[model samples]
Target: MELRQYLHAHGKDSIGIIGVSWAEDRFGDPSESRLQRIAAFIDPKIPVVRETDDLVKAFSPLEQVPANFVYNRSGKLIYGDGSPKLMTKKQLEGLLAGSK
Candidate 1:
């Protein structure tokens, strides 16, 4: 299962997934329609937000595009990587196992 599905099925209301798109430096706000389109490709209904000053402060600095950060329920950063493999089911299981 994907991250969202995995979380929904086994997370037991403990996990929430959100996507942050980092393109403000090059393209700026993608607008509501584009945000919706991005959300369309995302399974399990995850909220996708554009980068902003508040988001930067909340999510930490973005080193590159597709920065992935995993935060605990207390809002503390746990796992972070820039690799797309972060979506792999096995890797996600490993990432979330100890988190629970």
Candidate 2:
């Protein structure tokens, strides 16, 4: 929530939010339903990108749920962490500020 608030206040034009899911049905619920449940917690306007098995493998090394990646204006991956919870508001703010 802090990330959302910080982005809304300072990075509105600079940051782009995208949610990626591998669409695994291991939980018995459909990926769409899982995404819907997730959407209930966040702003619905945020676009969710569904990645295929190959795409998921290509984009991230962890191959785990809830990976976060931050890219700068020039499309360079400046920050990546396995857990979004590990990143603090100030750290995100600093990353954005330093990227510029």
Specify the highest-TM-score model's number: 2
Instruction: Write one digit per residue (lDDT tens) for candidate 2, span 1-100.
Output: 6656676667555567877766455445666776866855655667877667786565756545556678899999898855434566788889888999
Q: Model 2: residues >4 Å from true position, as ranges? A: 11-14, 26-28, 81-85
Q: Report how far off residue 45 is in candidate 2 (Å).
A: 0.7
The alpha-carbon lDDT assigned to residue 34 of candidate 2 equals 63
lDDT of 1 by residue, 1-86 (tens): 36556655675355677777766456675567766776666553777766678977765555665566777667777777454434
Off by over 4 Å in 1: 1-14, 28-31, 81-87
Which ten contiguous residues of candidate 1 have the minimum total lDDT?
A: 81-90
Shift of residue 25 alpha carbon in model 1, Å = 6.0
Q: Each candidate: what lDDT?
A: 0.64, 0.69
Candidate 2 to truth, TM: 0.74
Model 1 residue 27 distance off true place after TM-score fit, in angstroms: 3.0
Residue 100, candidate 1: alpha-carbon lDDT: 72
* TM-scores, all models, native as reference: 0.63, 0.74
